[model samples]
Target: MTAERTRALQERFGNALMPTYGVPPVAIARGEGARVWDVDGRPYLDLIGGIAVSALGHGHPALVKAVADQTAALAHTSNLFLHEREVELAERLIALLGDPGARVFLANSGTEANEAALKLARKAAGPARPVLVATENGFHGRSLGALAVTGKESMRAPFGPYGTEVRFVPHGDAGALRAAVDDTVAAVIVEPVQGEAGVVPAPDGYLAAVREICDAAGAAFVLDEIQSGIGRTGHWFAHQAQGVRPDVLTLAKGLGGGLPIGACVGFGRYATAFAKGDHGSTFGGNPVAAAAALAVLDTVENEDLLGSAARTGAALAEGMRATGHPLVAGVRGTGLWLALVLTAERAAEVQARAADHGFLINAVAPDALRLAPPLTLTPEQAASFTGALPAILDEVNP
Candidate 1:
């Protein structure tokens, strides 16, 4: 009977919603902790974590309270007036970045944060620098401005020319980055861990090398940490672990603990790139989102979820590796973010099998299954998924 409800909702979804995302098989009804229940009333362990956005997991009390209280108090003030929560959030993010002198511009999503970064870089470069360097296969956002820097050809093909010269180079090749960024370059944008490219991480010292190259070429170093930031990689920001600082940092995914909030932060001189009335957002740093973000930050610190994420992620990676299944090649990524690499391109089949067994994982690539469970995921919860893996793999048609 509940399955009929799921089917009915899906049918309605197909008719009402745009075809951009296609029809998902399961219709989620509600969630708590690291598990969610579909409309069919079937519980599934959530390993996807809303694509690494649910830092504290579903129905987290701190997040719930913050959002509730803030909404009840003052939801939207438009950008016309300033609010305390927004200022506090910006200050907290700058503190987390370890640069007290930095400045922040909040937006509604990662793409918008990145768009702000692009505008800052362009404004900084002015007419002298006309080129932007980005790594190949890098996924920033689908918006036209962010899409221009995004490395995927297929996604950018539909939009045609984006009125910007984006020079694409091989991922993790510092030499190529150096060759691309010269006096004519405005900025170089890259992700420490390329989340969409099957959770591929940059080689050791690659980010620091980019920083050096950008400094030498007088180009801004922009780090897109939308997926790898907010303790997903066991660090406040992935760049922090590398001991490399960026001129601009774009963040969103887990910043607000599932609330829609993104920030583009500028450090030192980059902070002054925008003059008065340079850029603004209508609902960017609304009080509710800022309050939600504060709660997430406070919870991460108070609960020591950063330590929890590191420990649980290690256990999950180790368990997956120890399974010794033939189809299982290896695991990639760090902290709570991970990807199970398969020997063959059968991730979709495995994902379906996993779903059948009351688990939810993402087939990020043909041969890669992404696992980004919440920071609150316990050892037992992780073990359950790992224990079920061999059986799930065995059932797949070879």
Candidate 2:
């Protein structure tokens, strides 16, 4: 994109939009597969995949047709009325979860899904359990309830006086998590892989330990899979590798392809937490969104994109590691959700340079470059990123 055009759009965005996001340098015109074009027609590889929401990639044919056909047939129907799409989607989700007894509560986004999960825990535990425990640096949604349970202080402190008493422990530390889980705990919410904290995975056996501790304490075990779920991490759910199941699972991000949708799933006794009229959403399970979700689920299974993501991600991470760049410290995380650890806090510079050379990546931390490209991203595209790595690094440190 031309500097003049980028500057003009930036100025326009600053004048018209809220300051929460400030202004992005590029104005995307359109996208196809894993590539997007700027307003001025410069193409760039989309490595972030809308922060792990675009599992099928840009303008996927099945997703497009599903959304379009469903919208044309039936778009919105509040929870007051039953819709076939919603029922079918629910059944599919339960089946995919490998828990036929699991109950699903759909929402508009990840935050709302997490909010609903929090309420479920609170309701199930009653007033007797007054505390919630989460891992330090674990990023849940920004809603008041989810934010309260979230471990990041800066994201929660500005809101002041959240109703829940949340305790934090060092992530991937089983002893710390066990110490925090007492009879007074309502729930222990954690992300299997810490997304915003530079793609940090839970230490092997850590999640299973938390599951055991929470079981002993009768605390709800809630896994917020908002970023790592829906085939991004080579599994339907990242915690599956631990061979344990969470009592409550919050999902979103890639649930509806590009459409906005989320779900809070409760299993076994936790399924009965919300009573009649206990909780609800007006547009949570819209027919169109459900249809889109069904399509995404179908595509993942039929096309075997999960295997592709796992194989491609492993190769990409290995190639990056072999590069031996001075900035490269190590590769952490798993499957498609991996990060390049840097010896110096120059992630922003690296990301900016990569984007300038037609690749979009996220600087998740001061020293970590996160990669969550679409599950459908080809191995060739992964190689392309590794091929361009040296120049990207040189441009940053030269």
lDDT of each: 0.93, 0.90
Q: For model 1, what is the C-alpha lDDT against the true structure?
A: 0.93
lDDT per residue for candidate 1 within 152-263, as digits (tens), equals: 9989999978999999998999999888888999999999989998999889999999999998999999999999999998888889899999999999989988899999
State the lDDT of candidate 2 residue by residue for 1-398, as single tens digits.
Answer: 35767778888889999998767867888999998998878898898989999989999999999999999999998989989998898898898889998999999999999999989999999999989998899899887888887788888899969977889999989898888889999999999989999999877888888889999999999999999898888888888867899999999998888899999999988887799899999999998989999989999988998898899999989989988989899999778888999989999999989988999999999999999888889999999999999889988875
User: Highest lDDT among the candidates is held by which one?
Assistant: 1
lDDT of 2 at 59: 96
**What would the TM-scores of all predictions be?**
0.99, 0.98
Q: Residue 290's C-alpha lDDT in candidate 2?
A: 92
Question: In terms of TM-score, how similar is model 1 to the real structure?
Answer: 0.99
